[model samples]
Target: MALTDAPVAAKSAKRLRRQPLWIIYGFVFPAMAMALVFDYYPALSGLYLSMTNTMEVGIQSQFVGFSNYVQLFTSSIFLNSLWHMLVLAVVGMTIGTVVPLLVAEMIFHLMNGRWRYVYRLTFLIKMLVPGMVVVEVWGYILSVGGLLDKICHFLGLPGGSTGWLVDQHTALPAIMFIGFPWVAGVGILIYYAGLVAIDPEILDAAAVDGSGGLHRVLNVDVPLVLGQVKLIVILSAIGGFQGYFAQFLLTQGGPGWSTMVPGYYMYQSAFVNGDMGLASAVGVFLFVLIFSITLMNMKYLRSSQDYAGQR
Candidate 1:
């Protein structure tokens, strides 16, 4: 009787395991389907399209091999656009990462809840404004005879009436500044949440050890929140590289392509010039660059965490 019951029990256990396996499959399939429909399918289609010469109005496409990529490499406009993207990536990362982290840290040290709530709400309002509206508003602010110019004039500064966006030398930086606050607000919120997650007891202990303010922040707060910083930095770098809307709406990649970025150039290639192959190649390049940077950041962050653990 015992031997017979053992086999029956084994069969029941097998059936139990199979039930949860099917449940997991049922839960995972919808997400997989959505990924294929939205992401994977488009990426695969783009890859195929990038290898062919597809005309704007024609139904026929001819295989062009890697000619599109070769042409992009030889194009001075594309090269310059790529350079502008690099500069934007560096500048945006600085503005998006550092400014927000500093602001969050300062706010974290403040004892007043009302002031913190006010600042948080202010940033939230700014973030809630439509991107197009922000771009348009800033375009006016940067224009000659606009509020910024009037303020500068009031201060008695030379070139106060100059339109920053209309100059090749300052066009990209002006657009970057317009987008900076939008990107920085997200980072600030992330850092603020991270700061709140820190243990109050740990902070008290640091204070008892005679570490005050700057020393405590540098030693205790920074290490604890390093993970959030890493996430913000990686996100900022990606946003910087892909920044397009403000530049497109405000400068139209101009004052001689000074405000041009990879996304803007890609749009011009595909839509304006009807060069879908080259545009797809540009897209692929951006994907690779962003992927590489993200991986490097992850590795460095993991290493830092390991070192902190040792200490």
Candidate 2:
């Protein structure tokens, strides 16, 4: 009798503890509605808009199939901009991905004391400044007679008074080299977290086996932080496509489209030229490209993770 009654009371208590479905829905409804209205609606509408002949608001919109995309691929200016964007993306990703990992390794190998904290803080402080401000500052720096000018004069190299940002031959390269040394705070933080989270015994064991600094870093440190490296690479790739704010704000696609990226091209099409359909088409292309790259990166990261787990 006691056991039967105990089980009955436990079940009753569990039933009593469960909340009503309406209450859960009440908590979730607002968020779901917001997502549908703000996120999904815009995405779907943009997709629909990309296929239409919409120029601007108050203008007649008509379905025109893939004409906008055809126009985009056929335009020499757009094609040139695409080439420039590719160059920027490749250079930016290589520098942005590799440099932070190196910086993180340097900081991680430092004596785990005041110096480590100081160094970490020094890099992370870059995150304090607004991203827009950073872009603007770099824009100024790359402008005529900016910081690069002084450095060029110091090094006895010919510094163009017209600035690399405006020179047709150097505009893209200037954008590529904006963040000198590329010690991005976010990358440093992510890589450092991965490094610190590593088991100390693994590193100590490497040292015990007569593994010196370079050997340990090459074999142990880098391999352990593969996940972080993968993450930064994906982020850089996505940023490569979407991160054209600098070009938009400063260069304005100047010097005959030397620094123009697809993102900035989209903005120029939609806002400046009032070609809504064309801009939406560009947006769609960028979204697809970025999505594809992210998926590939994720797949690679997963396989690497699996391999690491096997080892």
Candidate 3:
């Protein structure tokens, strides 16, 4: 090619590459706007508010410079709420991760395609139900003379009419029992997708080697889905630390703070007690805790091919 033609062709290629830059920015603009407005702005504002003694609106609250955080750490009520959050995180993460993996494995092994689809549809339907509706149904089930009491009546057990959400000893446990089976629908789908991604030859080799059932699951399947497990674990920990929907709906952190989780405590501080500064401080603490734990997990408990290679 001539030198002039070469330069022209190069310029044309550069223009073509630059042409799509505007389209990319156009597509990304909406998400960027949303993050700035909803996520980034609120986070920055909350952090600033946490350092002040702001309670009521329109009155200039003086900057207290970490006093809110100090109070949060020293308060017995906050400490109790932190403990409750930790327990819920542990229990929820355990059942949320393991149960869905088991369910997914069972579905993956189903011999009939129709039956497998039916099972998947059923799990999906559970997820279609709104979370608030589920909490309300559980609240009714725990109410006095509700389904629980009827079950106890069938067994001739006295004191079955006890108020589950109103008793200090039972409120937190009752909140935890809302999703009794604990096989989250989305979790099942994720694990199943991970299992489905495995090469068929790998499974055939396992079967040929006489590795099936529990032996196959522990040695082969589990390692294959470690990525899914790690994903669910991280998600569950974040949700458990931030979630208080059930506690708020069913118990309202009642029965003398027995069910007071950190999220609800923060809510009460802001909306109920008019202590926005403290609530903001709690929010900051929760953000740090989740960020730190997630970083540690990503650093040490990586979901990589090393374990799969070992297997």
TM-score of 2: 0.90
Whole-model lDDT values for every prediction: 0.80, 0.84, 0.86
- Candidate 2 lDDT tens digits, 1-311: 11012344555666566589999899999999999999999899999899998998988899999999999999988898888878878887788778887888888888677888898899888888887888888988888999989999999999978988889988888877777777956888788788888899998899899996778878988888888788877888788877787787788987888778888999999999999999999999999998899889878888987787798
Candidate 3 lDDT over 1-311, as tens digits, reads: 11012345555666555557889899999999999999999999999999999998887898999999999999998899999999988889998899999999999999678998899889888887899999999888888988877877889876445678887887887788887887756889888888887889999999999999989988999987787788789889999999999877878888888989889999989999999999999999999999998896676455364555576
lDDT of 1 at 215: 88
For lDDT, candidate 2 versus 3, the one ahead is 3
Could you tell me how far off, in angstroms, the CA of residue 216 lies in candidate 3 after the best superposition? Answer: 2.0
Which prediction has more favorable lDDT, 1 or 2?
A: 2
Q: What is the Cα-based lDDT of residue 2 in candidate 1?
A: 10
What's each prediction's TM-score?
A: 0.84, 0.90, 0.87
Q: Give the worst 10-residue stretch by lDDT in candidate 1.
A: 1-10
Q: Please give the ranking of all candidate structures by TM-score, highest first, separated by commas.
A: 2, 3, 1
Best by lDDT: 3
On TM-score, who's better, 1 or 2?
A: 2
Once fitted onto the true fold, the runs of candidate 1 whose alpha carbons sit more than 4 angstroms away are 1-30, 112-118, 160-162, 179-184
lDDT of 3 at 204: 98
Clashes in candidate 1: how many?
0
